[model samples]
Structures are given as C-alpha cells and as structure tokens.
Target: MAGVEETEQVKGATREDTQAADREPETLYGISGSPGIVVGRAVVLRPRSDDLVRYRLEKEAIQAEQERFQEAVDQAEQELKDLRSKFEGDLSDTLTIMDSHIRMLRDRMILDQTANLIEQKQINAEWALSRALYLVKKKFDHIADEYIRDRFADVEYVVNLLQEQLSEHGQQFPTGFAEPVIVVSEDFTPADTVRMQSEKVLGFLTEKGGTTSHTAIVARSLGLPAVVGVENITERCRTGDMIILDGYDGRVCLSPTMDQQKLYQEYDRQHRAFSEELSWYIHLASETLDGLRVRLSANIEIPNEIEGVTYYGADGIGLFRSEFGYFQQKHLPDEETLFSVYQDLVIALDPQPVTIRTLDVGGDKLAIQLPGNKFKALHERNPALGLRSIRLSLREKTLFVTQLRALLRASAFGRLRILLPLISLLSELKQVQEIIGQVMMDLTDEGVPFDPDIEIGIMVEVPSAVTMADVLAAEVDFFSIGTNDLIQYSLAIDRGNEYVAKMYDPLHPAVLRMISRTVEAGHAQGIEVALCGEMAGDVFMAPVLLGLGLDELSMRPSAIPHVKRLLRHSTSRRLTDLAKQILKCGDGMETRALLDCYLASNAGEWRERS
Candidate 1:
C-alpha cells in the first residue's frame, strides 16, 4: 500500500508533477485468505451516524424529529422481525422474549419518556435516541452478571446505526464492485460481511475485533487470515501498492523480494500436506504393537460431530458436553426440545456407548438472568468451588430430573452411560440415584418407554473423590478421572490463569499419588477407571496413567493415533518403573528428566508403526 499524499487534484500544474512524483514507498496489508493472491481495489464499509444539531431544534421541529424517530425505530423492528422470519435457523429467542421486547420497544412509556426529554430538556431526537439507549444499556450492564453485560454491545451496535440515520446519514454497501477486493474499514461489521459475499471478496483488514468476534468468524468461514487490531494501518495503506499477504503468519510485506514470496508459497504447500496426512490416519483401529488393545473414544459437543467420531474410528463417545445447547440459545430449552435432541443423538450413535454428563455450568460457564434464584449461589467469590456441577443440579432437582429423564429415555435407543460431575460426597451420587428413580417412576406412570438399566458414573475431579474412591466406586459402575479439574482443585491453580498455570502440574507427586490411589480404589472395587481430561491426550502422562492401571484413554481425535503409537512399544512393567521413578523424584525437574529419559529411550516404539 502506498501512503496517500497531497494529490494533483488540488495542486496547480507547476507543482502537480512534483506532488504526484513525491509518493511514499508501499507497505503490505496482511489478512487471512485461501493461500493465494488476487490484486484488486479496496472497498471500505462506512457506518452511518448522526451529524445534526438536535439540541437547537424548535418545538415544532422537535415534534417532527420525534415522529421521524418513531418511524426509524419501527423500521428497525420490522427489519429484525423480517430477518428472523427469513433466517429460520438464526431465530433463537422464545416467543415470550421476542414478543415482549418488541412490545416494550413500542410501548407509550418508552416514546412518551423520549418525547418528554425533547420537550422538557429541549434535546433533539438524535441526542434523545443516544440518551435513551444509554439509560437502557446502563440498567442491563449493571445487573451483576457477565451475560447481561455482554448484551450491552448488541444494544449499542443497533442504536448507533439508528443514531446515524437520525442525523441524515444512512448505511450503504458496495454493490457494483466485481473486482476481487479487500474490504478496508476501521472495524468490520456484520452488515459489511452480509453485503460482501465470499466469492467476490479476496480479504479484509480492520483495526478492531477480538479473536472470536464477527470479523474473525467470517474470515475463518472463508478461510482467510485476518490480523485484527493493526494500529496505524489505514494511514499507511494506499491505492495501488504491490502487496503480498502471509495469511498463515498474519504478515504483510510491500514490494516483497522474490525469495520471500517463494518461502510463503512453500509454507502453504507443506501445511496442506500435513492436514491431508492427518486425515489419512483417521479410520485406523487403535492397538499397541505387542497386541494390547486400547479403547479410543471421541469428546464431542454437537450431534454433527458424530461424523468426525466415525471418521476417527472412535470406539465410543466418552464425553458428550450438554452445556452447549443451554448456552447457544436465549433461554434454557424446555424438556420436549431437550428430549428430542438427546434422543436423536442416542439413536445416531446406536450400539455404541455414549456418556452424557449433566449440565456442567458455573465458574467460567455460568449464565445470567435465569430467574435470579437458580444460579444466585454462583455469584460467590470462587465460583468453581461454590455451588457448581453436581451441587447446582442437586439444588435444582427439577432441571436435573429433566436432563436425567432425557438421558435415561435415550438409553433404549442406544448404549447410554450417564456421568456426574464435581462429586465430592457419596450423598451427591445418592441424590442422582434418587432423581433417576423418581424420574423413572414418573416416566413409567406417564407411559414413556424408557430403559431402566443405563450405566451410571461420576467424574473423580475433587481430591475428596480420590480419598473416598473405594467406597464411591462400589456405588457406580465406573469412574472417569477428570484430571483437568482434579489438578486445578488439587493445586489451587486455574489453567486459564497464566501466573499460576505453571504451578498446576499434573505430574506433581501429590497429584500422581492421588491418581495411584484412585485407580487402586477403583480396581479394588472391581469397577473400571478411565482418564477423560486433557491428561488423556498428554503423551508424558499417558505412561503414568497406564502405570497406574487406567483401563481407557479418551481424548481429542487427532491425538489418538500418535498416543496409540506411543503405547505400542511400552510394556506395563517398564511403565510401572517410570511411575515409580516419578514418585521418588526429589523435585519436579528430576521427575521430568526421568520421564524424558524414559520417552527418549523408548523412542524406537513410536517409530516404525505398522
């Protein structure tokens, strides 16, 4: 991109040539893309905002502006309604929220109050609109919850558009640009993406948007590399600059040397090769070289991920997270909707074991505006420790029963297993047992053909669960160690927290001892134990788990082949020695050194996989 300088359009003929020739060197704009380049013009999205003096309006003009303001709001409402109708898949709000919000928007109280501001304070429609929006947002933002605070962004985006129109400026899009163009804007908006289809657009650049924002979403869908928050980029870029974009690295170069271009082209080629190679290993069964069989399962969220499960040759579904449904919608789904989704998933994965955990929301996953009483306990200082998972379910028996009923009912359609989360006490499992029994009676009385003998289990996340594992193991058919939370709880360190994450080592001797005890306890009770957290995918920890007598490993599909390859050369006897060395370590580094030495000495096992 060439920096824009004084143009010949305003300069006299004597100085025009000098001005035109005085252009700065070009700089490239790095954006995400499909590993190719198509040079074209830039189309910038211009957001509309009001430029009128609303405070100076006379009474007659103020009244006129109010009428226009009402009309503009009506137009926005109809537009949202029409969009909802047209995009059926996008309609997430219930009838109650949908109709009530629209009603509140047009209510006399809202309009009268806005007009009162205009008449009483002598403010114009533009200021009135902003102020009213600000007030509404203030109430929602101050509601003592993150979810409600998040809604303020949506409110501000909508009001800003209307505010712009109130000042006689309106939003517009690029309709006639057939050339492959990169969108240039301060911040890319949804309207900008909707108007610029994936085919005609090459890429875009913006100085805003978080990694998960609308800009990044569109870029990923189109397989474009987008580096957001690039300060001073707009001022640097200009028309007709020879630009090369390194989408992989989010690098942009101006008038790049041929060597640099060749480097990126090779990088793109090798990356594609790696993805294709990974896909090739998907359908293979997992087994060690010496004939030790291993159970490989998929960790899934949506029903759509079942295809991936099949492709990865997963023996069964290990963890089917249930919170995604609750979070993706505006409100908690009713029993009927939840049942249908559960039933469909069970039938789809028929003849294969499917472990469904109850809604595991709280800590980072809690919701706001749920009738106040439901999650009020989660508002405490330490949410991860305060009323989460099984505790929350026991408190809200109706919600818990609803989920259990759906899970139990789905069992008839497939091999179903139910897992409880965050269990510290045996009484919590007793609550689960009671809820399941009560729901069974209700379902039987209601003539629902639900299966009665689905396997029940609990995640061994808390250290207390480890302490009481032998007794607790007798109550359930199996135990799945949720090492992510177990290590977090044991070390008092959150993985999300960078300062303490390094201290949250799963290989800490105390953590290793806990694993050994829990596995020993499960074995003593004649129940199966499996590693189901990120540790299951850890190559280093896999040996330790195997040493501790873990029967199964559940993890990301991509890690299975590599992990299985590691297990091929490893003997249970040799692995036991490694675990013993780890336990005898003087410090963490000694344990790590022993582990690394063990892996390096056994490197021959990972190689020459059949």
Candidate 2:
C-alpha cells in the first residue's frame, strides 16, 4: 500500500498530476493460474539464464568437468531430499512431486547424458548441463499432451538448481522482504513456490506456466493470486514498482493511477463481500425452491484438489480428468501406479461417487513411443474431428485394457464410475463394453477383488452422439453432456481461433436444442443426465441447465457456491418456463435477450433474500 512513490509538487501542478505524468500505467495479460486480487510492489527475481555461460575446456580438463557436473547433481539431490524432509505427513502430493524431481536428477537421460556431454564435448559443467536440458526438452516437445509437455518445466527446475550449484550462487531467492510484495519472475518451480511465505508475498506474476503446471497447482493450494504465461513480464517489471494483480481476469497493471487504484480497491472489497455471502450457502443442499434436488459436484484434474472439493461442499467428483497420471511421469504409468492414484481418491471420498473420465488424448495431440523407444507425433488436419478419445482407446486396446483394469481394481475401495469421452457411435460403446467384460473376466481369473456392478457412462459431445443419444443411452448408466465441444462442433467454430471465437456462443438455439434433446433421450431410457463443461459452471446458465432436466452439474470448486445459491432461490417450474421461452427464440441474440431479461427481474430478489 505504501509502495507508490509520490513526486514533488511542481509549480501550478497538483501532486496527483505530477505523479500521473511521471509514471505511466501499463497493462499485461496472461492466463489466470489462480483466483484472487492483490495490490503490492513488484519484487523481480532474476532468471537462471543470467548465470549460465558456455566455455570450452581443455581435453585434460574434461574429466574434472564431468566430476564437477556429478558434484552439482549430488548437491541438487541433497537439496531436494532436505526439502522433502520438511514435508513429512498429509502432504503426500507435495512429497510425490519432490520425489519425482529426485528421481529425475538420477535418471540416465539427464544425469548420464550431462556427464557424457561434459567429457565428449570438452565443455564446462554449466554448458554440458544446459545442452542436456535442451536435448531432453526436444523429447518433451514431441509429446502431444499439453499437460505432459508442461512437465518439461519440472526438468528445467531441476537443471536450474544444478546450475545454481555449479555457479556457486549462494541463494537465488530472497530470505525475506521488507514489506509484502508481488513476485515477478521468468518462471517458478514447485520448489520455489513451496518456499514462498504468503505473509511476505502478496501474489505471483510469471513469464511461463500453464493452468495445470506444478507451479500453478502449488499457487492454488497456497491461495495465492497468480497470473502466468505473460511474455517478458520479468523484463517489463522492476523492483518496488507499484502493481495490481487481478487473477480473476488474468491482468497485471503496472504504475497504476489514483483512479485505477481506487477502482480496483472497490472491486476487491465487493469481491470479498460476495465471497463471504457465498460461504453461507456452502453447507446448503443444492435444490430448487420447489424441492427439485440436483447434485453439485466438482471437476478436478489432480488428486491434490480433493481438499478443495470437500471444502466447497461438493456432493462428489463429477469429472476427474484421468490423463494427468499418464503424463505426470517420464514413461507411461503402469496399472499399479494408476490404481494407487485412483484408490487414494476413492478411499478419501468414500460413499461419494467419484466419476473418473478415461484418457481423452489422441489425434494430433498424441505422442506415443514407437519401437526402439522413439517418439513420433501423429499428424491430423483437424484433431478435434480426427482419431481421438474413444477411437484411440479402441485402436490401442492394450492401453485401454490396462486403464480399465486399474479403474475396476480401484472400484473395490469405494464408489467409482467410469466416464468415457467422445463416444459418437454405438459400435465404439459396444467395443468398449467387450473389452471391459474381458478385463473383468481376467480380473476374476486372477482372483483380484473389485466391484462387479460398476456404472459406465459416456460424454455426449459431438452432434452424431446427440442424434443417437436415445440409442446410446440404453447402453450406458448415465450421460454427461460436454457442452464445450458440443457448442464448438455444432457451430463449426473453433473457440480457440480468434477469427471465429466471437461466434462460439453457448446461448445459440442449436446448442440448447442439442442439450435438451440429449437430456430427453437419457431420461427416456431411465438414466440420469449430468452436464460437465464450462457452461455448467456459469451462474448465468444454471437456471437454463436445471430447466433442461439435468440431474447433476459439475464445475470448478470455486463456482459451486454461487451456482448453488442461484439454483436454491429459483423454482423448477419457473426455470422450465424460462427455458421453454428461450428455446423458442430464433437466434442467439433473441435467446440471450430473453434470458437476460428474466435474470435481471429476479437478480435483486435472489440477492436480497440471500
């Protein structure tokens, strides 16, 4: 709060005018890694690249250089082990991450390769390590999974540690700050983030990271406001510069004016007040005023998020993206590894159904190892419409069967359901069932314990699936509408493409029809219907989804309270009528107008009652 420096008053100019003229505000946008808002002075952390220098070594010095590299590796391992020791219990996920780093340090791909490079190339220890990192990064780049490719950051983190040790940089991070500050850095590792103290660090602004990166995961766990993937953020910001971080909108404002600061202060106050109000609804049941009950579940990517799910009062986990385990490590996860992860999740939330969606990676996104341990990338003109999801699973039966075995084995622990992604044909469903049956028989022959009556479901995303929903519904136990892809595929628009992004609207009549028809088809076959997508989490779309006869809504943990509060205040009959009116509209504009009018009329009543 006291970071903004005031300029001396000039002749005929006010202090505010002088300060405003001296400092110009600049804004940078990036991906929202966590949620919160903070205003503080920036504390920039220098990148490790600054300490890296490549120099040729004499042939006789190669052996000593290799020994130096080995020493650095040893030091890095000891540092990680010491850090791991600090976290002893209940923080199993954090410990697992540390263990992964430790294993990576000793891996032949990194350890052996760097040592070999130092001797073969006759280069300094720092240069050999950097080259080894570059080669390993090339392999990571070949990985089709974005989440898996991001793990390269973890490798970089290890290398950074070794680099620091090799350079003899005493300590890269500051032990303490004079006042609370926003940390701006080229990137942060889980190690760096774990070492941070919330009392001294107000937020984080980084140049590299994704929503699923380890750094982002740690930031969320720490309840820090972070905006990552901003280009040149470290270069743009300097120490002690006044800054405001808006994690909700992925924005960073540097050198803010008085008006901007005041406005953001007011916004922060309102957000805090609204959060306090929502806390009151966390323990309430998700049901309409007329007593039409619906399940509110959370969609999580990793096991560490289980704490947030329970804290947010979710009835269960609606959608667990299971592919993270597949790419969390260097090699494909074995059945036992998968089972361990799945079992932990099931046992933690016993009696509450946890719906785990199978691996949804393939098409242009698939990076598989060919014979001789070579990585190959699959080429596809249109990955979304190409060989992905169910198709890939069927083609790779060995992979598919392995996952089924893990899922079934974990079922014995607690409530678990298997949700398949992108099932467009009845044949795909049948093939999956056949494989499941064979796997179950094999498990029985092996005398492995598992649940015999495990429920199976499919994601209704493509238009073909919507058209054949009634037929597919008869085969599965439940239906989860993936509106994100449904809307995109139905409108022939790629939401990620800037050219047609504005055309991707969930309120479009065709999108609503697809959802309505899928719900009807599922209900006709006596199966429950749930919506798990971006639409389900939106408070504005809660009434519409409820009116469409969905039995459950799964969303991010943070959105559960607001959506539940909206649903609890409205009656089913009113929402159904509103849905019917909107469906009759001819276009997206008309539908949105009608929905907005309804929400406007009832918004105040809902708030006042709350």
* Candidate 2 displacement at residue 192 in angstroms: 2.1
Candidate 1 per-residue lDDT, tens place, 353-381, comes to 88888888665555332433455444656
The digit string of per-residue lDDT tens for model 2 on 1-610 reads: 0111111111112123322346679998998998888987777776534546788889988888888888888888998888778766745666777788898898767888988888888888888888998987765554544466677888888887887788754455554465677878888778777777423788889999888788887788777889999999877876667889998889999989778989898888888898899999999999999999999999998897898899899989999988766655667788998999999999998999999999887542453422114334555556667778888788878888899999999999999999999999899899999999999999999999999999999999999999999999999999999897888889998765668889989989999999999999999999999999989899888888888889999998878998999998999999999989888989999987887998999989998887
Model 2 TM-score on a 0 to 1 scale: 0.86
- List clashing residue pairs in candidate 2: none
Model 1 Cα displacement at 589 (Å)? Answer: 5.0
- Best model per lDDT: 2
Q: lDDT of each structure?
A: 0.65, 0.82
- Which parts of model 2 are misplaced by more than 4 Å? 1-21, 25-28, 46-64, 87-96, 107-109, 112-125, 131-150, 230-232, 257-263, 369-387, 494-504, 585-591
Q: In lDDT terms, how accurate is model 1?
A: 0.65
- Report the error of model 1 at residue 68, Å: 7.6
Q: For every model shown, what is its TM-score relative to the native structure? A: 0.70, 0.86
